[model samples]
Target chain A: MIELYDYELSSDAYKARLLLALLGVAWTQRYVEYYPRRQHRAPEFLALSPRGELPVIVDDGTIVDDAQNVLVHLASRHDPTGRWYPQNDAGLTSQVSTWLAFAAALTPTASAARLHDGLLYHHIDVDEARRGAHEQLAVLDEHLWFNEDAGWSWLCTVDQPTIADIACFPDVILAEEGGIELRTYPAIRRWTDRVKAIPGFIAMPGIFPA
Target chain B: MHGTSRWFPVIRSEEIVPRHIAFVQLLDEEIVLWRADDGALNAWENRCPHRGIRLSIGTHAGSEIVCRYHGWRFASGSGSCTLIPAHPSQVPPKAARVRSYQIRERYGFAWIALGDVEGEPSLPELDGLPHLTLRSMTFAAAAADVAATLASEPGIVVHDPYRAVWERMGDAAPMLLLLQPESSAMTTLHAVAGNDLTGAGRLAFLRAHNAWCKEIRPRIVSEESRSAQASR
Candidate 1:
């Protein structure tokens, strides 16, 4: 049985979880509730991922820390003729790759901006991190503008869900808590809703009960 | 999540340049983009705690960030509700603040987040290669579903795609997959370089790749059960 660390607010963790569901892969979600104390840096959590990040998938006695790596492993290990991952779709692959990188820029920036804005109460003001988040959103806006009316289904196509959406969806959507208005970019807003419409899509934790 | 007036980057900061308003996207919530008068940037949750009117959409009068719906002004630095148009004589409580974020400039750009994180986000390390800004679009699937599609493909050209945008460049950059979940939004396309492929040639290769994505990425049929929150 595959086991994943439980995290209510981590989009990275969702990436792995979603893959397991798509494959009907049996797994357990272990809640790592470390509040009032940064348990991610603790020894027990550190054993899972030295970086103390979420979406660490433990499979076949191997612990995978990074989110994309876990997805790749699942696809490589599970898919026979590679249906979920087509061996030939280069654009979809590149888009997924790009979106993952984009997530790196958007997640912390948006969340941090929310903090500087004082959206959440407890943690904040570590050198004003939110500044980077808004800029990141602008880049996304530009991308949306470029293809606003293309009617492209996925980040790469119009038919199905791509790794591109999974790679970037979690953190981008969370920007709302930090006071980001997602409605500005029509394409982004539409795209986000489409992702949400997907079956089994989970919501990020709100700015309470943490 | 994508309506124009519904989610706008309210206004540039007095100290912030026009080309530099951060996109504060709230998923089904009001958004207000703000920058400081002293280059100390701050974007607030569009909803004001007192009346739920947007504070970031309004103009700045003196040091306060005001609301457009009503002339309620909150101090940008502290998010304190300072002025009430209906009751100008009243002194609002300390909690009369709009949700806000820490904004700053870095790497020829600005970033935002919701907490006092331990450190700034480090950029992704990549294999050296001239980059190409491939198309960016959102999909109707989860990051896992998307990643599975990419990994499912051992090679980089999926013909008969769903809907892809192909660049006209002729060179093909080696495919490198990076699923960075920390930063929000959907997938990112990082171009890889291998051998003596010309820039144009690499672009062509990417174009083919894009075509595959738009044409053939899997159509995920999600289930109807809500699980606990997770990541990309």
Candidate 2:
């Protein structure tokens, strides 16, 4: 069984919980208080993950830091079909890595805005974060629009969804909490709906269940 | 000027995938558009009557739409409240219903009439010819301003208060522009090409037109601002 350092309201932590549920892998969560308690920065938690991120998975003595790495680790190890990560296909694997990086880029912009608004992290420059988020969202919307034209549903070229979709789902879905409306991005809105309908998918604090 | 009485394009027909709710606005009136499994299209006010929550965020259950809150189910077409999970055995009140609008599907676009509409939607002639729908563009300028600007452009074949038809030169096909007034200060422009395109041809057309639209948007918006400044 994997032990996850989790925070209930943290979107990064929800990424691990979502993949674990989807993979049908039982995991125990060691809850960390991220907001008022600021437990993520605690020395004890920082010892496990050097960056002090909310999601750090310890699976059978092997430790994985960061949400994307945890997703990569779980999918590659547990999924018998290998469809989630698709390590066999080099092109698909490269595309997934690109989107995972994009998801990480969203943290400082979209997720930081959310932290500022909801969690009272007032130090974040919300206007700059919102502008950055919109720029990235426009790129994502165009990509998804072209994907729709190509008869593809998920983010990548493949038919089914991969870990990339899960990685990007949280920030996009919870964007409204940061005062970012999705009305302009019709394709992104539709993609979020598809993400919600995924099998074994669950909603976090601000996201709605399909 | 385009008034509330006229029908306007809300979305492209191909964009409204089944079991998905599309959020659109007409003159600042928010609406939620959804399609049923039986191929019926619905446009209703974007609020759930139970709690005034946005039905746009609700779930589409094939023939019915389920509200995200309180598990209220409203039937298609009629938009009547059919089920309330808290009281499954009892029937919902008569007033428990969603306000629906009159909608029509034509010319690769879904059109809606906001107020009391009497006749068919006024549109340019492209009925029999196969056409391609271009990506819609949203602008900060008013719809009337956008329409007037498009009408003033060269090669205009036909013109109306809210619709414009222009003859394109070279590889680009004839364009049909429809302006939808979302609010006093916001508008969305939808376009359709009067040519049947497929495969690489279609993709090329889409990319070209999309880029061209993006290019013209800033000019239109800035032009509006300049005119407003002049008037002021």
Candidate 3:
């Protein structure tokens, strides 16, 4: 059995949960209390993830700490068709990798704003965080707009969603909690609907199933 | 200065599809724009009357928009509070209704007047031509400044404070530009060209106009900033 260290409201953890749900994989969630208790920083959790992140996953004997790594692991290992990671196609792999890095870039600005607003992390400069998130969202929106113009639905040009979609889904969907409105990014808004409509998709807190 | 009583173009008609909500701003007022299943368009204050959370982030059910924070539902057209899921049987009071603006569809755009208005919004003449709307662009400058920049372009005629017509230059087709005053420092420009040509010609025309708008946007913003600095 796989073990997932998760916090219910953490967008990072939600990414892991969403991918696990989409893959139809059976995994037991080890709930971590992020607020007040700060269980992610506790000694036992630190043993699993030295970086003290929520969403550390243990698949059999292998341990994956980062959310993106966990997504890659699950998709590469469990998916029979090799669709999610798409290692076979070099061009698609490059696109997925590029977006994965973009998704990582989103966490600091978008997810940090969410942490400041929703979790009362007052130390973060929420104004700057929101500005950064909006900048990133504008770029993503333009990309999706052209994608729609070319009749593609997912983040990449391919018809099926890559792990890159799962990587970027949580922060963009929950950006409003951080005072970042998706209204200005209509294409991104429509992309969120497509992500939600994926087979075996599930919603975490603040993200309703569409 | 433009008053809140006058109608402003909020968004293009094609932007707000069924079951989707578009967020719009008019003169510093945040507005939620949505199209109902019945094809009726709605323009309401973007806040849920319950908790002041933005209704723009909420879901658009076929007939109503449901608040994400609390499961409060607001009806389309009327903007009346229809249901509170937690309360179940209890009907919300009349005061729970969200404030709505008068919205009308004209010339392929939704026009919203913040306060009560007496007559229809005046629009430029594009009634007979088959037209294509260019991608709307937002500028970090006042609407008046953006309008001035557009009017200054050679062969362009300003119809009014909010509308302009750019005459054909070279192979480019004649196009209309409409400005929406989002706030004191922000503006959105919507463009439409007569769809006299089809296929590659139309694509090239849209590309050319879109590129031109993108090129001028930064210049307009910088000019506005310079003017502000000079005034100071």
In terms of TM-score, the best-performing candidate is 2
Instruction: Name the candidate, 1 or 3, with the larger TM-score value.
Output: 3
Q: Mark the regions of model 3 whose C-alpha exceeds 4 Å error after superposition.
A: A32-52, A81-83, A118-128, B1-5, B49-53, B69-72, B81-96, B116-125, B152-157, B196-210, B222-225, B228-232
Residue-level lDDT tens digits of model 1 in A68-176:
7777777767757564554477776666677667776664577565544443434665344555665576566556534433445456553677566666666676667
Rank the models by lDDT, top first: 2, 3, 1
Of candidate 3 chain B, the 10-residue stretch with the lowest lDDT total is B122-131
In the order shown, the candidates' DockQ scores are 0.02, 0.74, 0.42
- Compared with the true structure, what per-residue lDDT tens digits does model 3 show for residues A76-118? 9988878888998899999998888888898889999999988
Q: Residue-wise lDDT of candidate 1 within B45-139, one digit each (tens)?
A: 76768767545335555466666566677775788888887988888877777777655443223344444555553232323544333333334
Report every candidate's CA lDDT: 0.53, 0.88, 0.83
Candidate 3 - CAPRI tier?
A: acceptable
Q: What is the number of residue pairs that collide in model 3?
A: 0
Q: Supply the TM-score for candidate 1.
A: 0.45
Spell out the clash pairs found in candidate 3. none
Instruction: State model 1's lDDT.
Output: 0.53
Worst 10 residues of 1 chain A by lDDT: A201-210
Candidate 3 chain A weakest lDDT stretch, 10 residues: A142-151
